[model samples]
Target: MAESTAPPVRITSFGYGHCRGGLRIPRAHLVLDLRTHFRDPHVAPELRHMTARDQEVRDAVLSTPGISELVEATAAAVRAYQAGPTTELVTVAVGCTGGRHRAPTVALAVARALRLAHDWQAVTVIDRDIERSVIAR
Candidate 1:
């Protein structure tokens, strides 16, 4: 297949305390600091251990009061970044306290939204703490 021309969206999940080498892409156009926007699922006993990949954790995080708007806003930001003058790749780091629950879910949501906003754009989601990443599109 031919390589995509549009910019790629790299959504990263990081922890607040340990951010030394969190990024694999090195540089980011925008870092969506989601640390303050929503409640940390790590606080809830039942959901603490469950990762954002779980259906329950995802639903719970998405239900938070302004999460939809936040994700939508991220898509809008990506649109603006698409039009800006720079390298076509757009890197966004979405961070929470632990990178276990909130950050991962939000990063995934942002990736999904970016895909919807710009169909031609590539997307990659990474969880730095866990060293897991969905390879580029």
Candidate 2:
């Protein structure tokens, strides 16, 4: 594989509610608000405590009527970043009501797709509220 000059893509999952004062997205090129898209997993008794990493939560997020379309759109944008200026970083922030569930799920899905779709590009997913280690590949 050819050596990549493209900057690493940073994807963050955050809660819109967490931005009590304001949301800070470092080097964010695009922000996708998922607040209105998927049904809230927190409302369900089974999924309430689960992170987006759980199979059931991920399924709920992905199974929405038009959710797949958004995923495809997001992946397409990340691929486009590969062709853009290498010196510039691309960041896509996915935000929902609470970062714990929906946002992370969507971000992870996109990051995985981006990784497979563009193997040479570096992709990372982070949950801002949860403060877990960055998931990258």
> What tens digits encode model 2's per-residue C-alpha lDDT throughout 36-77?
767777788887767787899888888877778888899898
Off by over 4 Å in 2: 1-5, 21-27, 131-137
lDDT of 1 by residue, 47-132 (tens): 77778878888999999998889999887887788777766677888777667777888888988887765565489997876434
lDDT of each: 0.74, 0.77
RMSD of 2: 5.4
Model 2 TM-score, 2 decimals: 0.83
Measured on C-alpha atoms, candidate 2 has an lDDT of 0.77
At residue 119, give the lDDT of candidate 1.
61
Could you say which candidate leads in TM-score? 2
